[model samples]
Target chain A: MTEEPKPRRLTPKGRATRDRIIEAATELIARNGVAGTGIEDVRAAAGVSGSQLYHYFDSKQALIRAVITRQADSVLHPDQPRVTALDSFDALRAWADAAIERQRENGCRGDCTLGSLAGELSVSDEESRTDLATGFLRWKDLILDGLRAMRDRGGLRADADLDELALSLLTALQGGVLLSQTMLHVRPLEAAMNASLAYVHSFATTAGR
Target chain B: MTEEPKPRRLTPKGRATRDRIIEAATELIARNGVAGTGIEDVRAAAGVSGSQLYHYFDSKQALIRAVITRQADSVLHPDQPRVTALDSFDALRAWADAAIERQRENGCRGDCTLGSLAGELSVSDEESRTDLATGFLRWKDLILDGLRAMRDRGGLRADADLDELALSLLTALQGGVLLSQTMLHVRPLEAAMNASLAYVHSFATTAGR
Candidate 1:
């Protein structure tokens, strides 16, 4: 399906309508999955008129992409994290702790929105799969930036593979969260993050610490 | 939906029909998510008549559970591994290598079948979610058994927590495969498994090697 270009600018009212549609779609998809959630369901949940729903999202793919973007933003730029870069072990621990804490608070019912989308869309949808991959890369880059900062500061060993380290941590988080969601427990996520954090710590220069 | 109890005993012909249905459903779900694949698709793919499909699987959820079990068996008990227990570091590396090699061979098109099902059903279907969780636990147990053997053989430190190690490895795997499938690359899986293996290695006794 061809995805119509979303308008770059919108009136305040238009923006509100569009946000409502995305919010509803996100919730529905979270519960019922993308295939289970229909366009009519989104329109009904958003309470937007038929033409209004089409005005913002030309196709379901476009709406799903919007959801993916929103999920990436929420995950990558959470409000609690004042700093974007994880420059130190303490910062990294805090990042891991925050994730585990969130899962506990939520009772581990919902999986990561981005990860859930990836699991559902990656194999079946090429365009959506690329978007999911981009989201993962951006997430990996955020961690990479921190690893780079740590290396520059002499906190990490010079020989440590920063790219591998970043990818490993992201992988651990994604895997950990998925298990936690499925099992309705936080142990898997905690263990995965703890092990990954230990791996990063292994490369830490004691003098820098 | 009520699930009909699977008959305890089936004639060879009856078993073949059931297996055929499951095989078809597995392929369909692999290409399209659980929500996307329907009973009709499975029946058509299996070349079974309408009542024949129902005779085996009372509901879609029942069929999905069978798929989950089959995937778990295929993943956890592949034909290539002679020894199921990963007692040594080399064995662990080989296990990880086999998974990476499979992804490479497949060109990273299919996500792990059990994982894909988990991603789709873990949130929406309680019964299927439980089955998935059981499958993950069984997989984790295989790793745990290896870790326990390693500790007993004095290859791993006695102080090491085997549960955490096993969970971490499994988490890394699920996460790594998910990323590899989504990104259509093997690097993420490599990084994740490498880091996990290294973590396991950290506990190896000096004398064990």
Candidate 2:
């Protein structure tokens, strides 16, 4: 094996070009919206000639679809080994803190990938909807898995309904984010997160532990 | 003197036509989204010809703005008993029940004007954003006023931060609604609402008594 761990040499330059296209697309979409973000704008941002862009992604929709896939990584990015070690209250609190901090850095502005997906919900049919749906499902799964592990570790209510509760927790945070963005105050998010943690703790109470 | 309580001949026929135009527009905008809705489509649905549609609302944007105003009424409609009798826990429960039941009818389906507003936040400019902001401020006022009574009546945490909490509660519910609609199920809403009630009871500290 070469010193660089033998990178997959299947057109590394093409892969880099594709990434540039997506990075440009992400920035444009966030500011101008799915309706307003045009392919020409993305081309200019990527600093690539028109033909170079077409060489990477076939169309604007294709570029957006790729950008969306890239967004899924943000949803569960930085997932850690401690993910499975959530056998304590402090651990859960830390997880909530990490999540809140992630959104806080942006003050939740111009990051409308999720918003765009929602805005397009009724307008976009099968393929686009699936693209949005996949992002949500993955977010749900990651949290559900984390909660399930906590439940098995004797840190949760023996009868805690992890699935329903996880759904509630995520939804509350989402609404809280909207409020935070609108009011330009982060307290709504903090409040929602606290309430959710309380709910989880209520169910996580072992009969005598 | 004119007979008191005599309903003005306020274009009774024209009034009915005007109402129909708005009603159809509301449903379409909620389900199809603002940009996706067409004036011609609203006219066909309302059974009002082109000039008739224009007679009531100047344009599709005007009609959509009217639909948004109507949506506010749908939430605060029939106006509660000035205040839900805060003398007992049951009263708060009743209010919660009313809200949950209302949300359940469509389970957060169709035009959440606030969600619709936020959905378009990236691209919507000053005027339309102001229209949406006005509706939200009014909605929050209704809830804040209602919660304040609970505090005054000694039925809630006397020191409870009513405004912040109200904003949080509303935001959480909307978030839950968005999630429920996304999941194609209402469990998330039910859980979030239940947790809200529990929070309310905790504030009262007769604690679900």
Deviating ranges (above 4 Å) for candidate 2: A1-10, A54-56, A79-88, A98-108, A113-116, A122-126, A206-209, B1-15, B79-113
| Deviation (Å) of B75 in candidate 2 | 1.7
lDDT of each: 0.84, 0.64
Top candidate on DockQ is: 1
TM-score of 2: 0.80
By DockQ thresholds, what CAPRI class is model 1? medium
Model 2 clash pairs are: A157-A204
Q: What digit string (tens of lDDT, one per residue) describes model 1 on residues A104-182? A: 9999875446777788888778888888888888888989999999999899999999999999998888888888988
i-RMS of candidate 2: 2.6
Interface RMSD of each: 1.2, 2.6
Best by lDDT: 1
- List TM-score per model, in order: 0.94, 0.80
Error of 1 at A144 (Å): 0.6
